[model samples]
Target chain A: MGKVFHEIRDPIHTFIRLDNDEKVVISSRQFQRLRCIHQLALTFLVYPGASHKRFEHSLGVMELAGRVFDVVTHPHHLSPEIRELFSQLDTDEKRSYWKKVLRMAALFHDVGHLPFSHAAEKELLPDEWTHEKITKHHILSDEMQEIWSNMTPPLRAADIAKLAVGPKEAPELEFDDWSTILSEIITSGAFGVDRMDYLLRDSHHIGVAYGRFDHYRLIDTLRILQAPPLDSKGEQSREPTLGVEAGGLQSAEALLLARYFMFSQVYFHPVRRIYDIHLKDFLCAMLQGGKFPTDVEGHLSFTDNEILVELRRACSDNSLSTSELAGRIIKRQHFKRLYERKPTDFQKNEQAALLIKQALEDKYGAENIRFDSPFQKGESIDFPVQLKDGSIESASSLSKTLNEIPVVKTEYVFIKRELEKEASLWLSNNKDDIIMS
Target chain B: MERNNQRTILLGMIKSLKDNKSWCGETHIQKAMYSLKTITNTPIDYDFILYKHGAFSYDLRDELTEMRADGFLSIEINPSPYGPSLAISESGQRLYDKYRENVSQYDPNIDFIATNLGAKGVTELERISTALYVCKKDNIFDIEECASRINELKRHVTIDLARSAASDAYKMLQEYEKHSC
Candidate 1:
């Protein structure tokens, strides 16, 4: 029994405890491969300290997910309405099973991320698949299958996949109520453990304060309350959801505020964004048919280590087709920010970057231009906040700060550094025409 | 779905909901879009998840926000503690007109979705839409079983509410079968 539990010291969560079964998971090759996968991808190129691996981030997520699972499912945390919905919640046996599954799901969630993580993810679709899908596949694969079955009570691969990737990404997978709520604990945009862990962990490693929040209070206050329908105020959906008490409203707002600041100041830093663009260019050129392998075996075979070796090789060898893009990463000759979306430019034309990108590509060849626009998740979270009156209100409506938090949207158009001066002059000359078009 | 097609169809639905419903908020459009795609022969693709409210699509939400940004949609912010409603902008109307033929075949479906769902409050919408979601997920049409399942899934929802919503979903299913494109 003494050997049944083990604890790993984590910077974010302090001590992340795991049982013997979970030890088998981390000891597996798939989980250990995370040691070679950097959490922020190539953000280290800009912030040298931002070199943490997915290994620790995954552990932190497991810790947070476990804590959140315990908090929201605890007897006191369970509202009478929630208990009525799932009588299974009354069972310690069932809660223990789900808690174990949630932790495992949290651990393996990002096992399928590509070497550079999400950089090439969006563009790879139609021809490829998402990291979530890959993670789902990994959880269901033979290697992990064996581990899950060896547990005291065997785990369902489907349950793990559903919780890890959530129903949104795994749209094809059917999620029952039991699975859906647990999945929300990990993937909900507002207060999911995944977002919570990444924000705190990334900020700590990247040496920024933007991602710090009162997580302890936030976690403690979480409950499976009934959320009414949002996007309108007159009616109640009375749906089960994970949220916080009124006391933690400030923490929830801070979490959203931190996300905004992090995106604006760190994740979307122009140099970091440009490095990703260059890395994507290098990857597409380096891979076969300019696509990451979709098959699990093929995807698992490549990590940042292997890709870095090839990147270095391509950097030194001028004869390689990808050498130019590779050198941009290795030698720091990445594209310069030629133009960024300004409020004035947006007021004139919403597709300002789209037009500018097209015109620039036409003038300087498509290969010389790169465009990056990251989607800003709307900050309006509808988690039901329990008020002092014992009434439930959507967080977005109850909190002034949450309602006013800005969505950090960015649109950057980059060009090969050599053409920056000429392009700048040319853009100034014809900018009005482009917006008018 | 084709880009222009999604834009035009969304415009048609937004305009329809605006005209039909007392308030055409983003949630209303999201639920309407789910029905349009799943119940009808609209050539669009969006992955629906049973979110806190009801069946929701993040891709659809993101696109709506993008449409608002790109002048295809406009928002009317309600007073504090209430969310904003959406309407198709002039540019959206122009684009809809330009691609009118693309969505013409699905007009009846869109109209049916808006008119039926528009007047319901968010709670009713949540129950009814989730009923539809259950039918879609499990391929089960038994209203009793669906209601029981919903009550079990969301205890806040009474079995009576679930049954009423399930009946609506079952009828909607029959209507779709009767009016299959």
Candidate 2:
């Protein structure tokens, strides 16, 4: 029988196709664990429809990454300089080898995300070990090694791991030029498929129009170009990076603006932030005994559903600290917003804002007053833009719309809903002191 | 000063270095800032620690990225041998001038360190910064002790290279102290 390909129906991408090798990867125990892990993590508490899992997102990223690779690496689409370099990978065999690598890298990028998806990362893991590090660990583990060995060409685990995380996170590992270019397709600062998938998928699930963008145009215009070397005497062997043709500039802007709006409107919604704080508190209390798993088997033992189950058990006991926090989330008794400093106010009166936080924390118990200053500024939107004349410039430089949009930073002070009246009275009297410079 | 205020001061320092035509790569800028803080007791709190290069600050890197996005700075990537260079733009100079008065307290420190360490290559700058970081971290002022620590921290550096780095660091510290007096 000819090679049978499997298609999984998806809401965002229409359908995700998996070949035999990809089928094995998807069927693996580690990959299957994504089904129980939430994509937005506690976001569903605010937007009830946003209960999408990472499993489908991973498939979407893989499908999008494959399309991107096809467009970027096509012989006809490359610039003259890049085309010369790509000529070396002329054969269908060589091209197919790289296509599989990129698809697998995209599929496994988020496999290492914790149960709450970044909510409990800083609280649980060591300072140096991020979700990316854990992802790398899972990729190179013995189980993954066996999976790779079973493939026809036998993929290199290191190559996939390197793409899953970027060069900065995994500085020790070295990648060839082709691998570096391919990895950029999956995780580059400019044209990464991970963000592309998440933005579209998050928008679809949350029922918001803010995250919608012309990703189709953006992907279709993807091209390869080489930036000029800075040193005058240095050799002109600039590395090829993913760039978008001139026509895609508007689409790129739309995509970036969508990211900003989603962050401000949906992701950083006051209700969602409070729920995240509560969920984080519950996880910390529940996993205080170093119960947060590190090994693959241990990681598989816990997922979003597992955490919810544990929280339910804790709520029933009424003795665990998780009971109070988890009960608040379960019962919809979220913390009340006592005070908030908008981005403009926080910029001018930062010191005064701190004083407000200090005064409130002193009045209320420290635990009762939660200060939320989400790091929301300085989103990176810089990417190489290929003009009609075949010259490369940064997207930020080329597009005025990109430069005008300021990064939004929101600060909030939350008090227990029971003490909302007292906090509101205190804030009214001290509002001048907090807002004034 | 607040973080945004410190960022203004940092941009001023970078502008001053650029005005003097001595601005180099990110590493040189980081070491220069480290020297300024240690010598003049500037209030810029980056919480730098000994990392791969020496006296590295991830916070400072984030600030640089912010500055780059704000059109205050630009990073130029050269070919293989040379590292990426950091340059202050015209708007960066304008912003620096706006906050020039606020950062006047650290002017002497910034000038001395930038002028002395500015022209040095990447290797020498890394060695000097690593030596100073080891000395401060271990509280070892003695040249030989600092050199030994540098050798331990950086496995590739030979005893001779460590001694040279230690000597350079010691000289810079002495010069900074003399200037402060």
Clashes of each: 1, 0
Residue A140 lDDT in candidate 2:
96
For model 2, the superposed segments whose C-alpha errors exceed 4 Å read A83-91, A175-177, A228-239, A434-437, B1-9, B17-61, B64-181
Per-candidate RMSD vs. true structure? Answer: 3.0, 7.6
lDDT tens digits, residues A1-437, model 1?
36878989888888999999999999988899899999999999988999999999999999999999888887877767677777556678877888999999999999988887887786654444788988988999888898899897899888899899997788677665667788888886578999999999999999988899999999999888766345453556656777789899899889988998998899889999999888888887778877788677888798899999999999999999888889999999999999988877876666788899999999999988999887566444456778777777666566667656666677899999999999999999999999889
Tens-digit per-residue lDDT, A7-103, candidate 2: 9999988889989999999998878999989999989888988999999999999999999988988878876666655543688887887788789
Residue pairs with backbone atoms closer than 3 Å in model 2 (clashes)? none
Candidates in order, TM-scores: namely 0.91, 0.77
Candidate 2 lDDT over B1-181, as tens digits, reads 7665676678766766666665365666787788777756787877676543456665676677666645567765444323356777776666666567776777777788777876665456667888887777678888888888876655445578779988998898888788878
Candidate 1 residue A116 C-alpha distance from true site, Å:
1.5
